[model samples]
Target: MTDDAPRNSGTELQTDWFDTIRINTPAVERRAASLPSRRSLKKEWQAAWLLNAVRCMDLTTLSGDDTEDRVARLCAKARQPIAPDLLDAMGVSGLTTGAVCVYPTMVAAAKRALRGTDIPVASVATGFPAGLMPLNLRLAEIEYARDQGADEIDIVITRAHVLQADWPALYDELRAMRQACGPARMKAILATGDLKSLENVARASHVAMQAGADWIKTSTGKEGVNATLTVSLVMCRAIRDHHDRTGIAVGFKPAGGLKTAKDAIAWQVLMREELGRDWLRPARFRIGASSLLGDLERQISHHVTGRYAAAHRLTMA
Candidate 1:
């Protein structure tokens, strides 16, 4: 799906949509655990899935020490994620990451570096990693990132609202952030690890979708636990439910701690099993990780050459 595709135009604050929802923790955990063990792709099939994961990746750099030079290099990686020789070996061409995610201050640098490409620059706004800032300032930060040429704005939601069960407040804040985003797509990061329960994750996901979040992300990558399969399953079910009711597909992004080629394939399997092939595209699904690309490169190289290369052989993400 492209940016031109119709977006989720959100509904009013309807507490009935999720007020009575209750999560079965053990069942969710059992299903999430069974996913990886049930399916395994091999050889060419594995390579193809990894390549798709590459196309759906949010190649990211969100560090306090991030600089323009680093953002430029990251954008360069996004443009040509796989080495030419490897891509040729796999019979793949025009392969690039879904987007290059960076801090709000680095959006311009990313845009300049990714010039002349279809890749979108996604910026984490609204006090990312921790959305504890005042609401006005957080909304201003969204506008700032949008003005800086961010094609997508990843806004972190205040976990307190979910903890306190203030569904109306959460919906109102997200709606304001969505308006502030203007033309840029808004991704509401629920930071599930801090929400304290699977039920909270499900309810938060519903609220975010109802408030016009183009995507519901699992984490900000700074939490103690980020993007667990169990948590992701709950979120995906909520997405499925939202689509069932509204006939609109909201995207899902699982960020933080997703490393290795196996991790890449596992999440894709989860998406395929839960949301079908349409959600496998970049428009509906994104895996947020920095080192994941490097590992994917290594695995692809091994697939083509039948030998593993040194980790240093691949370009740094």
Candidate 2:
């Protein structure tokens, strides 16, 4: 190879860059046309949309003492009743069982309590929040999560492979993880912040869906690389193109760094505008979050009780 020829590492030399990945999407401008008008997006993202999309909250913290008991209680709290403040805002928010997402070690406890309820258990597999580990170890983690009865498994894609534009390797990893999931649904985490470009995000989304991923996620919420509008737009377009071509719909989950009620709505608005109301089902979209629940609770309390609750009261353990 000449000096100007591309230099690739051992693994990079193994992939075929010319292989066909048959996903067809509209031009970028045309894709934008499918999205909601800026005025409409702004209007729909009011406090109302945020409140409605609070059905799923992610309790993904790993460093904890009462792992079992704490996760059990969080799931319990979700089922018993939401604060009237939250209910008033979303109308149907109360009486819903939001999922309890935890690490594999706590998967058993979470699944044990959530077994019969509508509330599902989510386990982070594939070396979670970071996809830097070896393939076998990640597969083992997914199998363990499945055996532990997790209803859903979220796995981070191989960033090294993805960033290197190794679509086939990424697809194989997703398929392998899916096999490890058994009956549990698998979520493919793109860790968008790390991917760094819309084109990469789009290609990753396509490769993930083609590889049997039930959902394509935005971030791990652990790495500082959380979700963003550009990634979401690119992902939604990918989802649309996939459905249009094959009639199989892939879901989207924007995990990490979302805090305010506004944050939730912004994502919802993006989905609502790009994917339409049908994709709004919990199955098709989810906000991978934890703190937003308390924020929603505080807002609900203020709306119903008519008194401003102290931030301290709402931040209860």
Identify the leading candidate in terms of TM-score: 1
What tens-digit string does per-residue lDDT give for candidate 1 at 126-243? 8888888999999999999999999999999999999999999999999999999998998999999899999999999999999999999999988999999999899999999999
- TM-score for each predicted model, relative to the true structure: 0.98, 0.81
lDDT of 2 by residue, 87-162 (tens): 6555554455346778898988876776667777888888776767889999999998888888888988987777
Local accuracy by lDDT, each model? 0.92, 0.69
> Which sections of candidate 1 miss by over 4 Å?
1-4
Look at candidate 1 and give me any clashing residue pairs: none
Which regions of candidate 2 fall more than 4 Å away from where they truly are?
A: 1-48, 64-66, 84-94, 315-317
* Candidate no. 2 TM-score: 0.81
